[model samples]
Target chain A: MEPLLSILIGVLVAGAVYLMLARSLMRFLFGLILLSNAANLAIFVSGRMTAGAPPLVPDGMDVPPEVVANALPQALVLTAIVIGFGLFAFALILAVRAFRSLGTLNTDDMRVAEPKEKG
Target chain B: MSWYLSLPLILPFATAIICYLLRDRPSGAWVSVAGSALGLVAAIVLMALVLQNGVVAGQMGEWPAPFGITLVADLLSAVMVLITAITALAVAIYALSDVDARHGQLGYHALFQILIAGVTGAFLTGDLFNLYVWFEVMLIASFGLLVLHGGKEQIDGGVKYVALNLISTILFLTGIGLLYGQTGTLNFADLAVKVDAVENKALLTVIAMLFMVAFSVKAAAFPLFFWLPAAYHTPSFAVSAVFAGLLTKVGVYALMRTFTLVFDHDVGYTHTILLWVACFTMVTGVLGAAAQSDFRKILSFHIISQIGYMILGLAIYTPLAIVGAVFYLVHHIIVKANLFLIAGISQRLTGGSDVFKIGGLYKSSPFLAVLFLIPAFSLAGFPPLSGFWAKYIIVKASLDESLWIVAFIALAVGLMTIYSMTKIWAEAFWKDHPDGIDPKLSALPGRTALLVPVIGLALLTMVIGLMPEPFVTFAERSAAQLLDPTEYITTVLGPEAMQAADPLEVAP
Candidate 1:
């Protein structure tokens, strides 16, 4: 399970990097989403997967009686996903605003803040 | 007892909510200022408590260590929080005049307060995962503030800033996940104990490199700092000031904290890499500054360079070197933020940020020129200033190690810094305005509001410079704490955890 998930994460990261390197801002946004999901999956797999086992302890017991999936990584991943969603939404809006105001999404042309010096 | 730990975090957040509700009113800005003042009081109390108690730790919601969220303050965290509050209050007051009513209507004060809360949270958190959460908090608020006015240049800069920072954030998250897999814990103190027992030392080093890369981007080190100059000059002056003062330093703080506390097993490998990164960051940053013609752009690049000095302190990994890093951290915040505030006033007076287009500052307002000279010269590492002592200690540390090239690089960077400062002075202050306009301080609206913070911060720079004894001693104690974190670990996890983790006792 760990090996297969690691391969999937690797592929996702490769694709995301390719998309992120593109010149268009929309493509960059897509890459960010892909990359964030890859990170979430990485956290999930790294916590050591357990098959169909919930993390709840049985009643009246101090600890779980059987092997259970790790709950902490799940919590951390949930928090990361929410935070990633907020940031991705923000980046999407910012890209749109850049498209409208700057009249292009090509990163090379969006050099208003640091314009090329006159030769 | 925990109130001391929680009050600094709570005040700014409470202020942020109230300011958001009152965004449409003139009083919202005042509420932000008053809240920041209270935060300063809270930070002072926390500093006093840490000074007396050695290391103070409190678990949130009564959860025990290694399982629940923790708020801890040693000398480093205490001083960082204290300095953070000082910068916040200064910027909040400056925003009363710098942030216009239109931005106020758009909830600028709320975002600003949230940014402060995020910075405070980052300084105080004891859990690695919790630190990442605080980073996200700081990131979102900064994004809002960066593009609040939504100018073409602003959106353009925001794209780069957001895109780059998000990449770093993902890397940091991945690092945290992998690390948790190895140690089964995320608390800083717990990781410090467990990491030594990891079977695969090589894999641990790999994870350490991952953290180094992620945090280097945050600190705006070389090859990853292009986003800074791109975005910083686009924001409002007050936003730039706080971002300049606090944002990248959070990265430096994380580097200092994690490297010292958790990743000390492979210092020879990690700290060596940090040394090269520090040198390249310094030379590249100052050279970048020399090419800039704008006031704020020059200051932005200098931030990258000064970051190198702090990283250099960490890279050297000596007690005096760590002391230099801590001293540099505090002094840089006050001096750098004050420089940005001065840049704002300079822009208002001269009607532009490009140094060539605007001039006559010296002839028109010697008082403002004097104000500018204080931080600018200090930044250049002149004698009898805060930056002088900071640069002095860092240089002495490298020389003590007999790293001739590193010492030479540090000194040469200081020289290059002075060159940039002189350029700003000659171009913007001494020369006549190209358009023949006299840019006087008195002519600017809200002159008092702007000048007050500038003056207050300048006095701070002077105070630290003239009386460096207490500050040096404080840095010494903080460095000792960083090098030997036994007290910190015990305070956070209690004495039993330490004894249980002690291998010698276990063998018996």
Candidate 2:
């Protein structure tokens, strides 16, 4: 399972890099979304796979029982997922705003802030 | 003492809330002002505590070390936080005059305060993951602030800025995950102890490169800094001033921290690469600045170049070099932010930021010209200013290590820096205004609020320049602490933990 997840993360990252290299801002944003998910998946898989019970401890136990799953990575992945969601949401809105304001999503054409040649 | 560690983080956040709630009222701006003043006081208290006691560490929520998140302040963190507070106060006051009512009502102060909180948290955090969280906090707030006043330029710049920074953030996260997988710890002190135990030194170096690339982008190093000059000059001057001052330095600080603390295993391989990167970053950044004619855009590129100097200090990796890096860090923040504020005033006075188009400040407002000269000359590494000593120490350290080429690059970059600074001084201050109107200090409404921070920061530059002995000694102590983190580790993880994990078990 861990190996399979790692492969998935690699593919996602490859696709993200491809899209991110495109001229269109929308493609770049899609790349960002995929890249963030790849990061989340990477975090998820870095914690080794465990086919044991939930990580919660039983009553009166100081810690979880032996052979329990690792909970810390799951928590980290969840936090990453939420933060990624908010960021991607903002990125999408920003993309739309950029399109509306700048009249194009092509990064080459969106050179209003930094014109190619100084006047 | 614990409160000292947490107050800097809390006060900005609390201010952000109050300012957000009062965003519609004029009081929102004042709330930001008050919040930053309080933050300054809090930072001073923290600095005093660190001065009294060498390294201060506290576990949040009463959790023990390596288990709960830690907030630790050594001398370096203390100084960074102190500088952050000072820049925040200056920018907040500048915003009082510069931020228009529409921008104020748009929650600009809230985002600004949140950015401060994020920067302070990054400086203070002891856990690696908490640092990522703080980076996110800073990123989101900065994104909002970057595009606050909706313009075609702002939106265009903001898109590139957010896209690149988010990519860096993801890479940073992946590094954190891989590091945790290997060592089973996220706390800096714990990782410093356990990283040596990890077999496969090659894998550790790979992880270190991941952190390096991620942080380099954040620092706006060569080949990855296009987003900075593009986006930074698009924002309002107050916003860009704070961004110019504090944001990239945070990246430099992270690089120094991780390299010194956890990734010291392979300096020959890692710092060598950093050495080349630092030199190119300096050359390219200054050359880029020379090509720019706009006021803020030129400053933006210079930010990258100065960042290279700090990284040079890190790459050289001597106690004296690290002292140069620490001193450069504080000095750069004050000087860079003041330059941006002066640019803001220039825009207000002459009604534009194009140095080629505006001029004649020497005739009408010699005071403003004088104010600008201090930081400009200091930035150019002239005698009797902060930049000279900073460049002198780093170059001297490099020469002492027989890194003659690196020293030459440092000096050449300083000369190029002077060229860029003089370009601004000649066109913007000395030459006559293209239009016949006089650009005077009194032309700007609310000139006092704007001029006060500039003058105050200029005075700081003068004091740091004339009295370099104490500052150098302080940086020397900070560098000593960086090179030897045993005191830091014991403070964070307790004496028992330090005993269990023998300090002498590591290879140099």
Candidate 3:
């Protein structure tokens, strides 16, 4: 499961890098989403797989009786996912705003902040 | 103990909430100033406590070390927080005049306070994942502040800044994941203890490189700093000043912390890479500044260049070198932020930020010119200024290692820095106004509000410059703490944890 998931992360990252390298700001944003999800998935898989076992202790018990799944990485990934979602949403809106104000979605064309020197 | 650790983080956040509620009123900006003042007091308390106690660590929710969130402050973290509070207070006051009512009504003060909170949290956190959370907090608020004006230029710059920084954020997150998988612990102290137990040293080095790239982007090192100069000049002067002063330094701080604490296993490999990166970051940043004619843009590029010097100190990795790094970090923040604030006053007086378009400042505003000269010359490493001591220490450290080329690069970059500063001085201060107008400081509205922080910070530069004895000593203590973390580790994890990790130690 770990090896397979690693391959999946690789594929996702490859696709993300491709999209991010594009000229359009929209593509770059989509790339960001893909790449962030890959990171989240990487976190999940790296925690190791323990199918169907909850990481909960029974009542009055200080520790679980069985080898439960790793809960820490799940918590971390959950936090990363939420943060990534918020940032992606912000990036998406920024792209919309950039399109409206700058009149282009191409990063090369969006040079208003750093205008080319006039010859 | 926890209260001391949490007060600096809490004041900014509480102020953020209060300022948000008062965002529509004119008093909202005043609330930010009051909040920053309280934060400064909190920082002073924290600094005093850290000075008395070698290293202080507090566990959240009463959970013991290696299992809970820790807020730890050694000498280095204490001073970073102190300087952060000072910069916050200065920038907050400047914001009182610089932020217009419409922008104020847009919740600018709230975002600014939140940014301060995030920065303070980054300086204090003892857990890696917690540091990531704070980074996001800082990044989001910065996103809001960067595009607060909603101009075409702001939006354009925001896109690039957001895109690049998010990539770094993902890389950082990924690195955290891989490291957690390797060690199964996120606490810095725990990692410092357990990393030696890891059998696969090669994989750990790979993870270290992942962290290196991630922090390099944050630090604005060579080949990854395009987003900084592109976006920094697009924001408000207050926002840019704080960003210039605090943001990248957070990256540098993280690099310093992790490299010293957890990743010292392969310093030969890591520090050498950092050595080249620092040299390039310096040359490219200074050269980039030389090519720019805009006021803020030149300062923005110089931020990258100066970051190189701090990284050089880190790369050298000696007791003296770490001292240089710590001193450079403190001096650069004051001088860089002061330069940006002065740029604001120059913009206000001259009605433009382009150095070529505006002039007569020296003839009309000698006081402003004098204020500018302090930070400008200090930045260019003039003797008896803060920058001189900083550059001297870093260059001296490199020469001690007999890395003459690195020392030469450091000196030559300082010279290049003087060229850029003199360019600004010659053009913006000395040359006649292209439109035949005198850029008088007194004529500018809100001149007192604008000039107060600049004067306060300039005085600080002079103090540090003329009286380097105490600061150098303080930096030496901080560097000692960084190079040897036994005191820090014990404070964070208790002596039992340390003894358990090394059973051969004789009981004292």
Candidate 4:
């Protein structure tokens, strides 16, 4: 199950990278989202995948039973999810503002701002 | 009330809520001012305890290590928090009216307080993943501050800054994930105990590179520093003042922590890379500064160069070098922030920080001139300023490491720093003003609120420079504590839980 999840996340990451290489600004943004999620899934899967079992300790447990799926990765993933949300929000705002200000969301049209500034 | 380790983290949070709820009231300014002063007191107490106790740590929720969030105040961390608190307090007072004028009173104070909270959090957090979260918090607040006025250049420059930082964040998070999977814990002390026991040296190497790359981007080291110069000079004086002071040093401090505590064995490979990179980073950054005609632009480039000195010490991995890195970081944080405030004052003097257009600032603002001159000399490593001691320590450490090439590189960077300082002085203070003065911009008084902090920092620079014994002794003691992880880990966790297995047993 761990190997299977790894392979699936690997393919998702590869797809994300490929999308990131595309020309449109929106496609690039999508690429970032996909790549981050793939990474999150990898983090979730790497702690030895146990399908359908939530990570909690029983009442009689001395410590978290080894049988419990790890909670650390889940906490890390939750943090990542919120941070990813922040990144996506900030990126979307930038994209929308870029569209409004530059009159295009295509990367190709964003080239003219750096031409030698007239003194 | 005695929880100095926690107050830097708490006050700003409470103030943020206060600033948010109290909408547009001048009371927010007073709240910010009071909170920062109180935070400063907390930081000083933390500093005292750190100096006395070596490393002071408390686990939140009264849980043990690796199970709860721990806040550790060591010498280096405490000094950083001290400098951060000082700058934040100064910038808070300085920004009061300016913030009101910008009508971003609520958001400004909120973000400003949050930025300090994040810096303080970064300084004190003993967990690697928590550091990333704090970095993000600071970055988000900085992004808001940078683009708040909604200018086109800010929007444009901010996009690049955001893009680059997001990539670095991913890299940092990815490294933390890799580290957690391997070691099963995120606490620094626990990681220190278990890192050598981790199965694969190669895996650790990869993760170390990921961390190095992430911190380099934040610290604005060499190739990764392109975004900093692209955006830093474009922000308002208040925003620039804070970022210039606190942002990159957070990265430098993290680099020191992670390298020593998590990846000490990989120093050989990293040393080789950081040496060449530090040399180039210092040289190229200074040259970039030399190329720039603007006041703040040159200083922004110098920031990248100064960061190289800090990295140079870490890369060398000697006790002296590490101590030097700590000293250099504190010195640079104070002087750099103070310089930005000087630029802020200059803008009021002649209506701009652009050296090409503005001049003869000395005539109008003699006090500002004196203020700028002190930090400038300190930055240039002139005798009797904290800057000189910082450089002296790094140079001394480089010599101790027997790296003549690195020592030479450091000396040459020092000279270039002087050149940059003189350029700002000559252009902004000495040269004649072309526009005479812009009536509207020059009409506004350069407020005393701003000058007071700059003066405080200037006095500190002089005091530290003239008498380097206490700081160096403290830094050395701090470095000694860091080099011996047993002292730190034992203090944080009870000695029994983290006692390493007998080395003799491992040898067989």
lDDT string for model 3 (B383-411, tens) is 99999999999999999999999999999
What is the C-alpha lDDT profile of model 3 across A1-119, one tens digit per residue? 78999999999999999999999888988888999999999888877777777889999999998778888889999999899889988988898888898899988888798887789
Cα distance off (Å), candidate 4, residue A11: 3.0
Ranking by DockQ: 1, 2, 3, 4
Q: Candidate 1, residues A1-119: lDDT per residue as tens digits?
A: 78999999999999999999999989988998999999999888878887777879988998888777788889999999999999998988888899899999998898899897789
lDDT (tens digit, per residue) of candidate 4 on B149-231 = 66676776677687778878877887887787777778898888878777788988988998999999998998899888888
Clash count in backbone of candidate 2: 0
DockQ of 4: 0.36
- Between prediction 3 and prediction 4, the one with superior DockQ is 3
Question: Global CA lDDT of candidate 4, please?
Answer: 0.81
Output the lDDT of residue B429, model 4: 83
TM-score (all chains, Cα) for each model: 0.98, 0.98, 0.98, 0.94
DockQ of each: 0.58, 0.56, 0.54, 0.36
Q: What is the lDDT, from 0 to 100, of the residue B145 in candidate 1?
A: 97
TM-score, chain B only, every model?
0.98, 0.98, 0.98, 0.95
Query: Model 1 over residues B365-436: C-alpha lDDT tens digits?
Result: 999999999999999999899999999999999999999999999999999999999999999999999999
Count of backbone clashes for each model?
0, 0, 0, 0
For model 4, what is the alpha-carbon lDDT of residue B95?
A: 81
